[model samples]
Target: MDLCFIVILLTFDVKSAPNPVNIAYTSVALSLHTDLVYMESPPGLQLLHCLRFDDCVEGGESTYLDLFHVVEEFRKSHPRYFQILSTIPATFHKCHYDRENPYHLVYQKPHIILNHRKQVVGLNWAPPFEGPLLVEEDDVLMYYEAYEELAKAIKNSDKILTYGMKVGDLMIFNNHRVLHGRNEFKLNDGIRHLQGCYIGIDDFKCKVQVLSNQVGDGQPPKHVGNQSWL
Candidate 1:
């Protein structure tokens, strides 16, 4: 099917290397993030198939947090910070000229997307891909303050779901509603191989809604990867 077409299913192996093209290919810990925030319509869902995960790997546990939950907590505890992040525009980018997969992309959006009555509707958060903030001078300090609070909230949240994968394990999740990261891993004479790909959010959501009508109690799911609060 068109939705499941795989262009070779981009693969990545985690092993100790002198130099790595993508940071994810090394033994480094990643901060909370979603993929491709720099794309206008980032993928809605992600699938990672683990071809191998050796027992000797010390860490490398994947962590996830429901972004909507984090945002809701932030909106309640730090309304002003929430306001700043929701109103100010931030740019994210993916640029490379001398790489095999060359790409140059820039997308600008408010950190938090709001609808009428200032309700949280969606999110645009990917710290590693964030580009020059390029905000008004006065808003710079305010933006940083807001960024710090949100970052702190994420770091200290207790709702994080952590899981360590085994060989043949597959992980599927909503890219828009979940913020995921990795724990620093030590590959002790072992290697980790993973292949991943994405599916359009629109298609995923359509099937979810359709399934709810047919198999569920004829009620749409409360959430289908769209960051809608209600």
Candidate 2:
């Protein structure tokens, strides 16, 4: 019964996926509200850390990678079914205007690429996009609450496979429908370290949005061009 409700709220149509799971513009405003509210939710404290590209450690947080500690911390809020992947490979997938056509070997940022073209290497300016979004990878634990929320949200998705979390904090989930990711990241500080730990996505209801809401919500802000499919 609850599953059906979540499916309705998240997918709108039983046979489709949420057009924009992240919930941009309209949701952006909601996100600010949600962030404030979620932050106030004590248990949700460790759920996420929305930081800029410059606050984390260098080497994309990889150098300071510490999954064990993160897992231990997550266990305080959620302890149950969870997996941990020791290491995951990083990709050079850029998230800028040129992201659609990725250059595996060539860096994506204009400044970085230009300097590299002129033979200036080792200069690491933060990657172009703000940060990676939700997705998943292998061997990571999901937090109980987040795990529950994601499970309820993605009960119907298939093509998406797993969700690689954006570049900020780790994604804690249930492992079933709540998939996780290591994400392609670059350093803004010391190193880029992302971790995960989860239990399930059961308790939380999917207040996300349904399909009817998706088509409407997916529509870009009025200011954009006729083709607001961004």
Candidate 3:
């Protein structure tokens, strides 16, 4: 209902080695906006920094300074403000399916334990959808480092409300547009994972238009090595 900006930060260090997450995110943000804040570290840590501060091995200081970089890819893509946010540690568990694979619940079954007591809710799925994949909330994990950036973006975006997100999956969206989220998840056995990125809607529209033109010309979209057109 109102314009907003979100910035999610992982307390972990990101300036030690090459940060694949920041490097990859820098590339994406540059596509959408040009006025980005580049990390101040040397080029060696371009894509090898740690994302989840709570999830990496310690004693890797000089090799793991928390370096944050912003790029033009984020600004030119959209004409709005971006915000950031953060999430505490959480765990996800595997899904338990029925004989017919009819899911007992979708989304995530987030749980928490205190004093050795565990709490939970009945099975619940999300988005009112069905697919061949039997994705369980437990399958989620806080795996990727780039996700903390993405989450921060979502938190500080204009007119975007992320319902919360599952860890581990790659969820892509427009940087300056669109909304995203994940159902709440549980914490048992200590596993959390989430991964994602942002793309400009203009770029996506261009790709779709190109694909449509190709199809109209009686040619399938170009393919390489069994992969769809990039």
Candidate 4:
């Protein structure tokens, strides 16, 4: 089935349950993660538009990290852990509850996804949706060590960018290459609202190619096709 584009309003919902089913609905601080990592093919592009913002709010700054840069540094400092994560597949799962449209999603993939040349290209690192370890009992500890190390690297890395979005601000990013999250804010402090949607990378590329062809002098760019799509 084709993926659907979702436009959602993000705000603290006091009445919503504080479970994984609706963690985003709460005002708690969220860790860096890629959205829908449990899906076989997660959304490639995400667009967030801030509809309203309270100038008096104390926190809720947005955060982002480029996984590609993190992987490069990880390969140098912790080669063994990098190898293990890139080679072994881990479990990710989620269940949606709607009596009329209940569904369960599960996917198995390595924390670091490699291209045909064995080069790191993408990653799936949503800790909140991570399922139980499927590795052998003996290797469980080893995996956890690697997992913890990677998580620390991501959290403490100086490469992370932080910003406070304002009303009418729009941010577009590649979901496969970037991990995003937000800090906690007091709900009683003020109001905040954001609308977002996702789009497939393939469709986005096609549109770009068509536009480039129309504008270019009938010559494909030299860098075209040099990079492979994940």
lDDT of 4 by residue, 104-207 (tens): 99887889876787677678889999998787787777788899999999999999999899888888887878889999877565777777777776666655
- lDDT for model 3 comes to 0.25
Q: Candidate 1 lDDT, tens digit per residue, 141-190?
A: 99989998999999999999999988899999889878888899888888
What lDDT would each prediction earn against the true structure? 0.82, 0.25, 0.25, 0.76
What residue pairs are clashing in model 4?
none
Where model 4 places Cα greater than 4 Å from the true spot, the runs are 1-21, 96-101, 211-230
Instruction: List, residue by residue over 1-230, the lDDT tens digit for candidate 3.
Output: 32122223222331222234332222121111211112111011011222332232222111110111121233234212211111112222223353344323322211111112211111111111222333344432331233334434434545433332222223333222222222222233232333323332334444555667776564442211111233
Better of 3 and 4 by TM-score: 4
Compared to the true structure, candidate 3 yields what TM-score? 0.22
What is candidate 2's lDDT per residue for 1-230, written digit by digit as tens? 55534321221111112353322211111100111111111121113332333445222221112222233343344333222111111122323344444432222221111122222211111112213322253322332334343233223333233332335544433221112223234343233223222221222212223442566564322211111112
List candidate 3 stretches off by more than 4 Å: 1-178, 217-230
**Model 2: runs farther than 4 Å from truth?**
1-52, 55-174, 186-189, 193-199, 205-230
Report, for all candidates in order, the number of backbone clashes. Answer: 0, 44, 64, 0
lDDT of 4 at 80: 94
| Top lDDT hit | 1
TM-score of candidate 2 relative to the true fold: 0.18
Quality of model 1 by C-alpha lDDT: 0.82
Q: For each candidate, give its TM-score against the true structure.
A: 0.89, 0.18, 0.22, 0.82
What is the clash count of model 4?
0
- TM-score order, best first, reads 1, 4, 3, 2
